[model samples]
Target: MSTIIHASAAPKFPLPFSHAVRAGDLVYVAGQVGVDPQTLEPIGGIKEQTEQCIRNIEVILQEAGLTLDHIVKVTTHLARVEDQPEYNEVYAQMIKQPYPARITVFSGLGPYLIEMEVLAYAPSIRGE
Candidate 1:
C-alpha cells in the first residue's frame, strides 16, 4: 500500500499536494521551489535557489527516512537556461558522486528560478 508523507520542516506548499508519497520501495517527492521554509518566499539567484531547492528536497527525503543518497532520479525546471552553469556548480557540490539520473529543462517558473522533484529508493528503511 502507498503512504503519504509530509515534512514539517519543509516549506509549506502553495499548491495542494503532499510532500511525498511512498509506494512500496519508492518515494516520490513533489516538485519543490527555492523558497524558505519559514518565509515561504523565493530565495536568492540561481545558485542560491538551487541550493535551497536541494535543501528542500532533503527535508522531504529525511521525513521518508531516506537521504540524498537514496535518490534514484531527479527532474528540475529552470526559469532561465542561462542559469544552468551556476545551477550545475551548486548541484555538483550538493549531490555526491554516483549521482542520480536527472533531467533539467528551462521552463517558466513565475517568480522562482528553480524547482526540483526527486524519486528515492528505500527498502523498508523505516521498518514500515
Candidate 2:
C-alpha cells in the first residue's frame, strides 16, 4: 500500500499532484519549485529560489514525520547552468554532510529558477 502526504502549511499550488508519496520504505517527494508559500510567487535569483525549494521540500518531509536527515537521494533542476555555483551555496547550507546522493541538471524550468525532488528512507515503515 502507498500513502499520499500533504502539508497544510505548505504552499497550495493548484496542481494535480501530492506533495509526496510513500511506497514501502521510501518517501518520494514531488519536484518542489521556489514559490513562496504566502505569495505563491517564484523567489528572486538562484540562491533565494534554491533556499525556497529546499524549504518547500522540508515542509513536505515534516508532514511525513521525516526530515532532511531521512533523505537518501536528491535531484536538482536549474533554469540556468551559470547559477550552479550559487545553487550549491544555498544547498550546502540546507543539507548536511555526509550529504545524500545527488544529481544536478540544467534545463528550462518555467518561471522558477530552480527545483528539487527527493527520495527518503523510512526504515520503520518498510512493511507498511
Off by over 4 Å in 2: 124-128
Compared with the true structure, model 1 gives a TM-score of: 0.94
Q: Give lDDT: candidate 2, residue 9.
A: 70
The TM-score values for the models, in the order shown, are: 0.94, 0.93
Tens digit per residue, CA lDDT, model 1, 1-128:
99999899999867889999999999999999999899989998998899999999999999989998888889999999899999999999999878889999889889999999999999632222
Q: What's the alpha carbon RMSD for model 1?
A: 3.3
Error of 2 at 39 (Å): 2.1
Which consecutive 10 residues in model 2 have the weakest lDDT in total? 119-128
> Given candidate 2, what's the lDDT at residue 44?
84
Worst 10 residues of 1 by lDDT: 119-128
Measured by TM-score, how close is model 2 to the native structure? 0.93
